[model samples]
Target: MVNPVRKDGTLDPALSIKNRFIDISPPKVVGLSNGVKAIEWKDGKVIMLDQSRLPLEVKYIECTDYHIIAEGIKKLWIRGAPAIGIAAAMGIALGAQDITAKNYREFIKGIETIFDVMLSTRPTAVNIKWAVERIKRLLKERRGESVNRLKELLIEEAKKIHEEDIEVNKAIGRWGSQFIKDGDTVLTHCNAGCLATGGYGTATAPIFVAIEQGKKIQVIADETRPV
Candidate 1:
C-alpha cells in the first residue's frame, strides 16, 4: 500500500519506521518518519515527491530532463527554499549530464545557460542563487579539469548541497530546541517548518527537536486550515 506523503513528503512515522530506501531505476525516494526528503539526485537524474497529490495519493516524479525540474519549480511541484535550491543544483547537474562538450570552455558555456535557467525558476529564493553560484564557483575553480571530470564534480557537489542542507537544518533544530521547553505551546506562521525547508525545516525544527529531547510541546500553525 502507498503511504500518505505529508506536505513535507515525510512518511507516516507509524508505517515507515521499519523501512526507508531509494530505488535507482524507477526512482522512488520513500521516507521514514522525519527522515523524508522532498527531493533527491540519483543516477545523474532528479527524483522528487509529487507534493501536489498530497492527502489523496503518494506519487513520485523522476526527471531525467532539467527542464522538467525547472517546470516543477515553476508549478510548485517542488516548493520550499532549501528544496527548490536543492532542485536547482540537481537540475543543473542533470542538465550537464548529457552535454557532449569536448573541452572545459565549451562545457562551462553550457553550464552558464543552465545556471541562469535554474535561477529564473525561483528568482526570489535566496537559496536558489546560493546553490547555483556555488556550482558556478566549483566550475571556475576546476577549469583545469577535463569536461568529463567537471560533470562528475558537479554531480558530487550537488549531492553535497543536498547533504549540507540536512545537516544545517539539524543544527538549527538542536539550537532552536533550547527555546522550546516541556509543556510549551508554540505558534508559527506559514511554511516556516518542514513544509518549506530541506529536512527538519526552519521554525518547526525546534519542535521536532524538542520532542526528541523529551519535551511535551504543542504547536499551532497560523496558516493551516481544514479543507
Candidate 2:
C-alpha cells in the first residue's frame, strides 16, 4: 500500500513540469532549435525562413530573387544589427549567384540593385549600410576581376561578420567583469545580449563572466510591459 502522488512526500511540481513540458530531459547546449543549420545553396536559389514570425509560426520562404531577402531584412524577419549585416552580405552573394552579365556595366548594375535593397533593410543601423556599401565598393573597384571570385569573397566576408560577433561578446565579458565584486546584484533591461547579437551577448556578458568567476550575483530580469 502506497500513496501514488506522494511517492517522495513533497508538494513541489518542478519534476512533473520539467518531465512533461521540456523536450530534452537535461537540456542540450546546442539543441536543434538554437544551433546553426548548414546553408543550403542550390545552383541558383535562396531558401530561408522569415525569423520575425518566429516563436509564433515557423515559416520558411524561398527567395527566387534578391528583392525578397531585402524585404525580409527591412521588415525585421531577420534582425539584430550584426545579424542584419551578415544577412545583407548573404543577400549580395545570393544576388550574384546566377549572374551571366557579359560586361562590367551589366555586372555592376546587378550588384548595385542588391546593394540599394540591402541598405534599405534597416535605416538606423550604421553597420548594416556600412557592410553593404563596403561590398559595393569592393565589387566596383575590382570590376576587372572574375565575378565568381567576387562572389566567393562575399561569402567569406559574410561568414567573418557573423563570426566576429562571438569574439565581441567574449571581449565584452572579460572587460566588464572587472566592475563586479564577489557578491553583487545585476539588473538587465530587455534582451541585450545573446539574443540581440549573435553569441556571447552585449549587456549580459559581464553577468555571465562574473558567474563563471564564482562571484555571487542575483539577476533582475526586467519584464518590459506597458503599465
Candidate 3:
C-alpha cells in the first residue's frame, strides 16, 4: 500500500508498511492504473519502454545486461525519476544474476560494479541513488544466503520495487486530486506523466484523478524539444 502524502507534501513511509497487501484494481478505484506499464521485470530481464520512440513508434527494449540498462538510463530511453529508479533496481537484479560468483562474499563483491554503473548513469536523479541503496541494503542483510538463493531474492526484491512504485503513483494521484478544482487547467513542464513514471504520473496525476472524479480539467504541458 502507498502511504498517504502528508500535509507538508512529504510521504509518511510508515503508513505503507502496516499492511502486507493493498488492492489497486483498475477502472474501479481510479482510472490511474487502467493501462500501460512503462517498466517491468519479466522473463528474468528488465523490459522497459523505449521513450525516444515516442510520437513515432512504440517499442520495448528487453535488457539482460546491466550495461544495456545503464545506457538506456544515460540516453533517456528509460526516462523519469521514478522510472529510472525502477530501472536501477531491475538493472541491479539483472547484473546480480550474471555474477560469476561462487559464494556470498564473491557475489557481494561483484555487485559493486553493477551499483557503480547504475549510479553513474544519472547523478541528478536522486531516486536512482535511492534505488541502488535499497539493493545494497538487501545485499547486506541477506549476505549469508547461498548464491542461487541470493540471486532469486534479488529478482524478487526488484519486482517488489516495481510494484511499490505503481502503488505510490496511485496514491499521489488520489491525494493530489483534492487540490484540483473543476474546470481547472493544469500547466506542466517536461515529461512527468505516464511515460515518465511506473503509471499514472507525478505532475499529471492530479489531472487524471480529477478527470476521474468527474471534474473537467484542462492540462497544458510545456513539452520540450531537444535542441
Q: List model 3 lDDT by residue over 1-227, tens digit each.
A: 35477889986776643332222222433233555667888888778888788757779998888899999999988888888998998899888888889888888899898988888999889999999888889888988899999999989988898778777877888999999887666677887777777777887777777777788655554565641
Of candidates 3 and 2, the better by TM-score: 3
**Residue-level error in angstroms, candidate 3, position 53:** 1.8
Task: Name the regions of candidate 2 deviating beyond 4 angstroms.
Answer: 1-51, 54-65, 223-227
| Candidate 2: 10-residue stretch with minimal lDDT | 22-31
Tens digits of per-residue lDDT for model 1, 95-203? 9988889898899888888888888888898989999888888988999999989988989998898888778888888999998877777777766555355666776
lDDT against the true structure, per candidate, is 0.76, 0.64, 0.79
Q: Which structure is stronger by lDDT: 1 or 3?
A: 3
- Sliding window of 10 residues with minimal summed lDDT for model 1: 23-32
Best-fitting candidate, scored by lDDT: 3
Query: TM-scores across all candidates?
Result: 0.81, 0.69, 0.81
Colliding pairs, model 2: 52-77, 193-201, 193-202, 194-201
Q: Which ranking of candidates, highest lDDT first?
A: 3, 1, 2
lDDT tens digits by residue: candidate 2, 138-224? 777777877677777776666676667667877888899999887566677864655455555677778777766777666665553
